[model samples]
Target: MGILTSPIPIQAIKTLCTNCGVRDLCLSIGLSNEDVERLASIVTQRVKIRKGAPLYHAGEPLRSLYAIRYGFFKTTITSEDGREQITGFQMAGEILGIDAISENRHACNALALEDSEVCPIHFPQLERLSHELPSLQSNFNKLLSREIVRDHEMLLLMGNLNADERFAAFLLNLSHRMLSRGYSPHAFVLRMSREDIGSYLGLRLETICRAIARLREMNIVRISGRAVEILNLDALRGLVAGCNRHRQS
Candidate 1:
């Protein structure tokens, strides 16, 4: 059984929103100390999910929004033909379950790509608290707006970019996000499989491999298995410049 499939003991939880390492990247971004305390009160506990275990499945009733305290996850939607379409990947400090807020049920499945811990913030209590904390409300709105912008960008990537350009844009985007979170942008390990990357980029597995090989040949990035070291960030950025300009225009 998965770590989170059964009841999690209270002792298993080691953090809360107030003392969380990634609070600045999460909902605690604009809140005061006192306000953070109020937010922390609603986050009763953290849950550990084993790698490959799901935090929640599509159509499950959404009860809480999970803030990733550590590790990574991928949210996906399955098609009628039984194919999984990767929607997005979530890393430490990111929030999940926002998709459920609109329908009161999850629209996609959130699976931990690695062993992960997440703080569960009760949604009803969060709504009540947000009303009392204007800064919290504003932050929540910004999170929603960020999601919308991300979705828009994905659409642009899928529609306008070719296979190699899509891969380049994907790397640049991940690099930017990782840098913002204080990680080395030029080198990082990919937790997800190449197949997963192919699904997210809307390309076939062979296509993804070809794209990677092409990038490697050009010395834009050096990929040794899952470890990726960006060798020419500017070249990678240049590959996607046309698509980016199109989006801007």
Candidate 2:
């Protein structure tokens, strides 16, 4: 577990969404100035979690949905045999705990991959406010729909794509998401471990290593430990598309 770093003061954390450059990609999008101001009232003071700390555990009662102010997280589920499966990785500006909205309890554990800060939006208050604000309600619906689409895409990747193609699609998806958050599309650190990534991609760690090595050999990406620099995004996309064509055939 990584040590917790110094966190911003509560007062400073309160302005997170309002001052966030990526607010356009978050739930705050399409909100009026007044509504954005109102939003600040419902959000709890930013809470910091150390790497390896569970932000919320499976079966915990859902109190609020969390918005990542900064850093990264991995959500996982443990099976009856005690095997853990990585469900997803979340980055800054993304929402967590949406799955709990359906059953009123968290379905999986959300763990911090690095020192992180999150804004907890009181779910009941958010629901009440959304009733009066049609735009807010619409945005909330969109968020849920987006999650469904993402899940469907993941299923497609896992079921249809070969190992190399699965790895390529994974990198491309991460690049797109990071680019949307104003990060460089061609380079970034992989916050989660190779084992966690393997779990998420439904591959063994050895297979992941082989795929990465192959990509590097092809000069499609330059990887040093966890740092990745995509050298040929077009070639990577072609690999993904080619896999889809093979699947269709």
Candidate 3:
């Protein structure tokens, strides 16, 4: 049970997107200046979700696509036996709710890992605007494709990588994304907990803790609770490459 707060004004959301620091990484990336202004009109409102709150839940009718303006989220699916699998973690500038485009209903739950703000793009208007703006349409397709590729990578991690390799790759991927957002590549706070990391990586919580400890012992990374510092990025990359070689052989 998560709380949904009142939405910020539509005008506010538009202004935020227009001046957003990471607009290049968001849906507005390639739009012409005029089209970017047009986009401001289509983005409906800024919805605020408190920590531990769900932005949307499984089976909910899909009415909008949300772009994270600030904070983090984890999207998850629950099994028939009640096990929850984390499908993805989202940060600022990433799109959410795309999975529902086909079914018209959300297939998973998106929970805010921290207090967050998101700009909700009304789906109907977005579709209509896409028809008018070729760049917007192309970007939408790329976003969908990127999600598919991310899913494939997750499958690869689960199928081919050992626990240590999996963890290292996860950290590397996070670093890459953070770097793209202009954040420090070697150090950042882990927004999600060990259990959440374990769920996403298909490992037990104890196993995740052990892997983190092992990385620290190897001088590859230093983890103090939720803070992580990559001490030897090359070593982490080597570990990942070694795992890939094992998979290929």
lDDT agreement with native, every candidate: 0.87, 0.86, 0.88
Please report, as a residue range, the 10-residue window in candidate 3 with the lowest summed lDDT.
240-249
In candidate 3 the C-alpha lDDT for residue 71 amounts to: 92
Q: Deviation in angstroms for 218 in model 3? A: 0.9
Deviation of model 1 at 72, angstroms: 0.6
Model 2: lDDT of residue 121: 86
Q: How close is candidate 2 to the true structure, as a TM-score?
A: 0.92
lDDT, candidate 2, equals 0.86
Which stretches in model 1 have alpha-carbon errors above 4 Å?
5-16, 243-249
Q: Better model by lDDT, 1 or 3?
A: 3
lDDT of 2 by residue, 16-66 (tens): 667877678777889986777677678747678888898898999989998
Query: Largest TM-score belongs to which candidate?
Result: 3
Query: What TM-score goes with each of the models?
Result: 0.92, 0.92, 0.94
Q: Supply the global lDDT for candidate 3.
A: 0.88
